[model samples]
Target chain A: MFFHIILERNLQLHPRYFGPHLRDKLVSKLIHDVEGTCSGRHGFVVAVTAVENIGKGLIRDGTGYVTFPVKYQCVVFRPFKGEILESVVTMVNKMGFFAEAGPVQIFVSNHLIPDDMAFQAGDVPCYETSDGSVRIQKDSEVRLKIVGTRVDATEIFCIGTIKDDFLGLTGDPGGAA
Target chain B: MASTGGEEEDASELKLGEDFLKAKCLMNAEVALILEKKFETLQQLSEDASSQFSQVFEKSLQYVKRFSRYQNPEAVKQVREVLSRNQLAEFEVCVIGNLCPETVEEAKALVPSIAKKDRMDDEQIEQMLADLATIKKYE
Candidate 1:
């Protein structure tokens, strides 16, 4: 999910950056420090859309540098439970398959797949039906539901399933679209 | 054995999201084949439904087909989540998820309680509609 959020930060500015371009310096520093970072409270800060307001700068005791309070609006993307995502299957094995959607990697355990399909072992492992009508392997696309997730600063690992309706394979390999 | 056009899920794919979901169901061989041909993506159910429920299944089989508006159950589920998170009422979320009201006035019509509608801000309602637009493709 995406949210428009406001966040505050105290920016410590070098004395050299205290000139006419101070605001520009502060914004660049803010973007560099804030963008692409994640916090457990707010999720991922996708981008710094704008700096809403900059409060009065206060000088620190030991250093001649100034601390400026910056309030900014940004776009954030956070994954939540029960969020269904359409991700591409990356690897298939007896256990199940791994798929990546955007920055998130989700695992669909074999146990969660529909009971009709069977796993086949090969140089490139895949899951198929007894009749070989449907198969899931690397590069295949699937619609999966997020059952659980573990989000870290850099990436997300999710436990997902394709056992529900309107999920699974889209088109069989030999079939015409 | 797949080329997941992702959103263009066949019948079997849609069926995964539901369970004997009461609708225009089918027990006849020809209807099964029609469903297979039309929604080839859906997994055909096993022939052995509990004997006790077979009669009830047969009675409701005729209406098992998916409606054009609600063709993608995944989209419907997503819309429901969006509504619930935005503080929309429970029954209202179900109604909106089904009807998928695209505007505030339209949503107010489906959820007749003006007091409930007054609780949600314009942005929350708009975001709900925007989310619904993404899932309108199952038809």
Candidate 2:
């Protein structure tokens, strides 16, 4: 007569039984452990298990535990910090003007225009040149003031003005075209 | 023969122990591999997130630069109203003269009414104007 006992432990006996969900859980746990152990370490590791069962009486005789090989791969990444840049305007309107500098876009508001400068109602920052030419344009350069920044959601709002002497038009007034 | 059977049993037990060790090693390896894959995926996500953050920062900076031009308190509505039309004209002269008394005297001379209302005597006005000229020369 033969008696069989199913002695189960935390250990897995076969690799085929390891599913994606379990693998994911194991990976997350490992990462947490690694991160906790090391301060400011930039990456994490993943583990894969493969189990094989070799026979009949092995289960009944307290010999169920077997060893298997595991594969490892490292994943690394460093957090990013944004870049600051200057932009030039390509167009203007009553609401604002469009500007481009590097890979970013910029806007200058009507309120930001100098008080001495004339702004026609409904003209969207339109003005007349000294030689009788009417030009509706935004200044090429503007100084930007950051009001708020959101990193997780990736959003930024900035207030722009041209009132500063250093931030607006440059050179002799006659040379402006 | 009984001894031989005992020896076989002993061998079987040893084999089972080795199997158990092998299984444990395999499990550890699997866990490591899974964790590595997860790390890779998370890493990619973080990179993408960081890139987006950078773009937002740049855009925000541009807006700040543009809005900074209008930050002057002197340009607000109530302040402008208080200056009045005449005050604005006088302010313009003051600005042109670089806030010198000579410029104020010139303005008074040009606008006789201001000179009379301000009660500025001719002698006082002359002295203020001369001092302003001297200041202007040094500037």
Candidate 3:
């Protein structure tokens, strides 16, 4: 899921960057330091939408650095367990397949895949049914239920399953274009 | 923190824990629109060296562009309106908008919380699906 939320961060600026463009420097630095980072509380900080406030700067005597508290709104993507998500398959192997829903990587093990679909090995590995009507391969869009989520300091991993009703290939494979 | 709702972390029940219960949920279409506009202005401001974005930003841009069912802002807004008019929760509204399920059954399956005893009936789910389909058709 994507959330638009306000987050606070304290940014440290070197004394040399204190000038007319201090605000710009601060905002840009905030974006540079925050975007793409993942926290256990917030899954992934995708983008910084707007800077709400910048607190009064406090200078450190030893390092000649200024610490300014910044509040900004950003878009974050977090996958919760039991949430149904549409993802694109990124790779296929005997172990299972790895799919990505935005920044979250979900691994669907063979046990999670429907029993009818068997793994096929070749140059382009995939899992397909007997009739071959439904296939899961690289770039195939699928709707799956997140069974588990592991949120780390810098990464979020998930285990998904496409074995339930209404959860499977969403679109034709290799036709994302 | 105190457990005000006293609900467990269950997406099927729409009890999305305390951290996300009140957070504003953004659909893929809304995200796509926001990112595109932000990217355009960011590009204009930083045309030189520091313009490259982070992996999360880049990946999210690509993902939203690829998965967003609604291509235009108006369609996105209308989808939200239709869902809101039906009294769906914030999370359900975005999930329905993002998935664009074709049938009421599928919608219920995808978001089981809506199927809870008194929340929504089949007809209401059908109507919502039809409304969403219309937006996608005309979008």
Candidate with maximal DockQ: 3
Each model's DockQ score:
0.02, 0.02, 0.50
Q: What residue pairs are clashing in model 3?
A: none
Off by over 4 Å in 1: A170-177, B1-139
Candidate 1 local Cα displacement, residue A78, angstroms:
0.6
What does candidate 1's lDDT look like per residue over A1-177, in tens digits?
A: 334567899999989988899899999799778766665445555556679999999999999999999999765544444545456677888889998654456899999999999899988688988998788888676667666666565545678888975567753333321
Instruction: Please tell me which predicted candidate would have the highest TM-score against the true structure.
Output: 3
Q: Which order, best to worst by TM-score?
A: 3, 1, 2
**DockQ class, candidate 1:** incorrect
lDDT scores of the candidates, listed in order: 0.57, 0.33, 0.87
Candidate 2 stretches greater than 4 Å from native:
A1-85, A120-152, A170-177, B1-139
Q: For each candidate, what TM-score against the reference?
A: 0.54, 0.24, 0.94
In order, what fnat does every candidate score?
0.00, 0.02, 0.63
* Candidate 2 accuracy as lDDT: 0.33
| Number of clashing pairs per prediction, in order | 22, 48, 0
TM-score for the A-chain in each candidate structure: 0.83, 0.34, 0.95
Model 1 lDDT on a 0 to 1 scale: 0.57
Worst 10 residues of 2 chain A by lDDT: A38-47
